[model samples]
Target chain A: MALKFKTPMLDELEKGPWPSFVTDVKRMAARKPACEDWLGLMEMSYEHKEGHWKHGGIVGVFGYGGGVIGRYCDRPDLFPNVAHFHTMRVNQPASKFYNTDVLRKLCDMWDRRGSGLTNMHGSTGDIILLGTTTDQLEPVFYELTHDFGMDLGGSGSNLRTPEGCVGMARCEWSCIDTQALIYDLTMEYQDALHRPMFPYKFKFKASGCACDCVAAIARADCSIIGTWRDNIRIDQEAVRAYANGELVPQAGAHGSEKYKLDIKAEVVDLCPTRCMEWDGKNLKIWDEDCTRCMHCIRVMPRALRPGLDTGATILVGAKAPILEGAQLSSVVIPFMKMEPPYEEFKGFVEKMWDLWMEEGKNRERLGELIQRMGLREFLKACELTPDPRMVNTPRFNPYIFYDPAEVPGGWERDLKDFRSRHQA
Target chain B: MSEEAKARIIEWVKQQKKTKHYFNDLCKAVPEIKMMQAKKIINELVNEGRLKYWSSGSTTMYMLPGQDDVAKEEKGMN
Candidate 1:
């Protein structure tokens, strides 16, 4: 039966050097009728050149609005086996850590009840249990929540699964407790997860620092990244040692990468802010002019450490296009202290939701709403003041409309006050 | 697949006369009924309006609309 099934659209991938997902689906098609239908649907979709799964339909566990995506073959009579093959999404454990025992139990339950197909985790960070009928929805929900001690994740147009990088749990340079914040937000906004009242989907992703390991700035509607406002703590002694090349060692010595530091033209000359000064004997940085690009830190990790004035930087407008091109989130808030309860952070998120719900068109993202209605109108509606930190470069504040006669003192002072108040 | 079972199940449902039951629950009450036979019979009855179906969450319940007002006796119902 391996060669019995035919698909031309999927064969296109096998021709390229890159390994493809079609190969995996084809293997499953040999035994499972659902997989045959799955392949057929994909080939049909590829031929049509846009996804046929329109997304919204009334299907999920009771009391939940989002998560289950009910997909049917566009030509259903041709593929009857997949007519009611809905996808169930389960909330994953924090930081994606799971015991092998728990995973076994989940797989066993799915095998008994569902189509025996699953995507271990979806891109949105939820366990996607694919293919089931409406009859299986509640019982599957009961199996996960009651038997396995798990809860349903977000779905529909509400808050999506909040994804967090393994922060203080694994990395030393983590600026905030990303896992804790994500967990807290998930718990606090459980209703938002279950209820489908929003205009469109909203995503939250956290990265420990500007490294953005999760690409939250490009993928998340609300991007939270850990950062510091004060001077970068530097060990001058380590810098001098590295500069003199004392740390340089042989390849297999103690399993450490050989360290060679040549201070000729790298650090000071390439500093984006030009705030670094390296005299014959000393190294210094004017922290005020720094925008925290993480370039210098990446260059000399042994010498410099993150500052004590730590918080998260909030950015908005990240999304894939519906009306425009994909965009990275623009900086909005410079420094917000990372703490529990997160009243201020949560409030600001709710405010954004309120604005989006009121003005957004069907299936419009928060980023698109900001795009249609200018960033100024969004800020004004949310009651957040613009800050200098929000600017990626000079002349970036869209609200600063200069009048030549009033510019020097009045407008500049107003703009400066607005920025400083928000930053402070 | 048994016409006798299908006719008996429809008769049994009609005998209830004033009660509404979900498909699974109605099937469970009858000891000799096969699930596949019951589902097909229910689908036919529903299409002919002799039986009507509505969903409460994921469960689909069936009943006769004329007998749906068993709750009319409760004047205080929301």
Candidate 2:
């Protein structure tokens, strides 16, 4: 009545403290043929002492070069039932917002045309439908995109998926409208997403604030983090309320002073820029030095609030690794206006893509290319004027100067000139 | 160290014929060439792009360029 396969080696993985993936797959294998295939592959991998599946073959829906990853079993003669297990990526909704009925319909469609096993949302923010043959790919694509109103997400290299956090829609601390921006970018870059023509994959992630709930800075090739340029609004009354402290029962049961007013030590002492100061009554921030790291906002959320003047800080050249080591996105454009249509953001991304295309080696990521050349070269090519905010790490070497003309005694003269023009 | 030793090392390396030879192996073949001298010669050749050095697992071996057909089997996604 149902497909069955033996997995002795897979069972061996179920032991110990951690809950095993084999057990999870077994639960899915009850009715799903795709799960059976996935399980069979895993078990075969253990038996053969290597992975049996080979990725990447010319399998895709018409008019799209990507959105699908083809996987085939090398030991097809032994396990013919689980030979072809291609994966299809359905473009995800911004902020992962989905109704119960929409999910049910999606599952039903997958069951009818392809596999029954699905990863609701994958790492790339796509509805990943696992295990389907080449014959089913077109029908599945047609029904998903044309009938159910869903588009295919990227797979190969041009661009992976663009992800965003639930910003102003659901979160209070959200400095910008992240969902709207992500949706606009996704729609505009649909061609780039579906085309496999880049030297390597590129990803975009958005975070509401420097709390980085979505880990945009560490993960995405382009990190669009919401921030405020103006001073953080501080409520002195609330600050006093938190700083005054509350009496609490000790760990051994007596109410104690061990947990006294330690806000100064915890919050004030931890500020990297030493912008925060508590002079017995008031807590204030020297706004100029505040890097918008969200430390103060998080430490005293009730007292410190994000400024109303919000935009996004754009970072680039982040990725896991390929040739070079993993890198966090370097701050490029510190603050850009975040509004609808996102023309400036879109243009900047186009410039980056064009440069990478012109110069990037095969399988070379943006970070690797930038590492081989220099960040200055990229900025100059993009017509970006370097700013103090753009420096992620403190440029320590005296030899390395941003402006060649401002070398030797010229820096002192430049500061004098700046003070005379503005501070004077 | 000397020009004669550098020339000898380069000639021996070029005679490797699509096969990769390690620093130790090169020293053994050119017994007169010291380990440090062999290393210096290899580094110079590598910098000039005349020789290609690839790390296979933990061992790094050097061979002339255009001998990728032999190197390809061992070379993963570096």
Candidate 3:
């Protein structure tokens, strides 16, 4: 029998052009027609009535034992691919060397046994399988682990999938290996990800450098940004080429005479720590205290480059909506050595999670908890000695008010006479 | 044409008067009424001088004139 379904109301469609959920349900309906009851519920969501389905439900996936989400589907059959299919967060390989053939084989198995549709990455940083029955769950998991060498990520209240930027493989700007950090954390904190015993969600992200292309600034609860303590490398030949009009500045008023002069005087002259010094013939950089602000590099792109001996800097408390508002991740552990199977990085992640889980309130994200309790408490709980670089002191002025009645001598009598005269 | 619609509109008007609401707020309170219908009714009341309208930004508010002040002026003239 073909299951019957109705469209959602006009008011519900006010947000976008196409209804997002309807499309998903339609896909499910194609597979399991009986699941159309889910569609009916969604259509009548605003009717304010009771039915067999309420707000939430528990869904399980094959292979994965823990981290199940209690979900609610207004239209079940419409989401047939996801009907019984739950997300499985597999720890990414230490080295992200994906053999195209291996990936294709996994996808082929998934399409045959499960729903053709898949979310490459789930909310918790898991590889989400859209739909699979309870019967297929165990076999699929065994195949994934024993055959494919895959592991699951976080599901419930645990630390979610750790993510990172494409390191030295493609980009020249990357100073440290983000791929290694992501893999190491995944292996070390497998228990934290699979377990469901935290106040709220915990997220982590790693960037190749401070450029933060992964949006580590706003997305993750904990962020690791790659940085260098060394100075910038400047090439005088490139600076002169730009200055003499042989090369044009990347943007802004580069071609103009005023901009050229400003670049020479303001930018080249004001290089802090004498990073950019002009010796009549050529410009040279000190390569010691550059701070990597990329100020010089951005101005004279052809001339300046980033230095070596760079490592990762750990930042905490970046999440959107859950705590207060969107916040940039603050620097926590200033710098740590980055290597594969990173024990230092793994230890940091564990300490952060333990502190947050112990103190965080219901629905409060790690960032919100850090903001409320202050970073001092977090550092103390984690037993990390306060580094001078980590100390963030907020400035405030104390106000002391003086009482007029406390003024000595005849000041009281003068005020009394003045009050009597002013009386209406 | 529905009794519910009429009751809703009446309730909206009463709430508007109690809260000293803008005409736009009164219109918003009764979403069942079309924008043109709400505008027409407000214009009719304004034209008949039954209600006074105040313009704020792009929106308009409506209210009855002071009945006590009008009565006092008439009494003074007499």
Best lDDT among the predictions, by candidate number? 2
Q: DockQ winner between 2 and 3, please give it.
A: 2
Q: Which stretches of candidate 2 lie over 4 Å from their true place?
A: A1-3, A12-20, A246-261, A393-399, A402-424, B1-78
lDDT of each: 0.72, 0.74, 0.59
TM-score, structure 1 vs. true: 0.73
TM-score between model 3 and native: 0.61
Q: Write the per-residue lDDT of candidate 1 for residues A1-424, one digit (tens) a residue.
A: 6544468868888777787677776776776677788788778788879775433334455555556765544455666667667788889887788899999999888877777788977888899888876678889898888889888777655678899888879876789899999999899988667654455678899988888877899999999999998889888876776677655322223346555555546677778788888774567889888777776676677777788888899999798876678989978777899899888998888788777755676567788888889887788787888666666665554556444553465532576878877975
Interface RMSD value for candidate 1, one decimal? 16.2
lDDT of 2 by residue, A148-225 (tens): 788888776547778999899988778878899888888887766764445667889998998888899888989999
Chain A TM-score per model, please list them: 0.84, 0.88, 0.70
User: lDDT of model 3 at residue A196?
Assistant: 37
- For every candidate, give the share of true A-B contacts it also has: 0.00, 0.00, 0.00
Cα lDDT of model 1 by residue, B41-77, tens digit: 5556655656654322222345664554422311222
Docking class of 1: incorrect
lDDT of 3 by residue, A245-363 (tens): 66667544445342342454757666654566665557666655454555676666677666677887787888777449888787778778787767787787667766765566655
TM-score for all predictions?
0.73, 0.76, 0.61
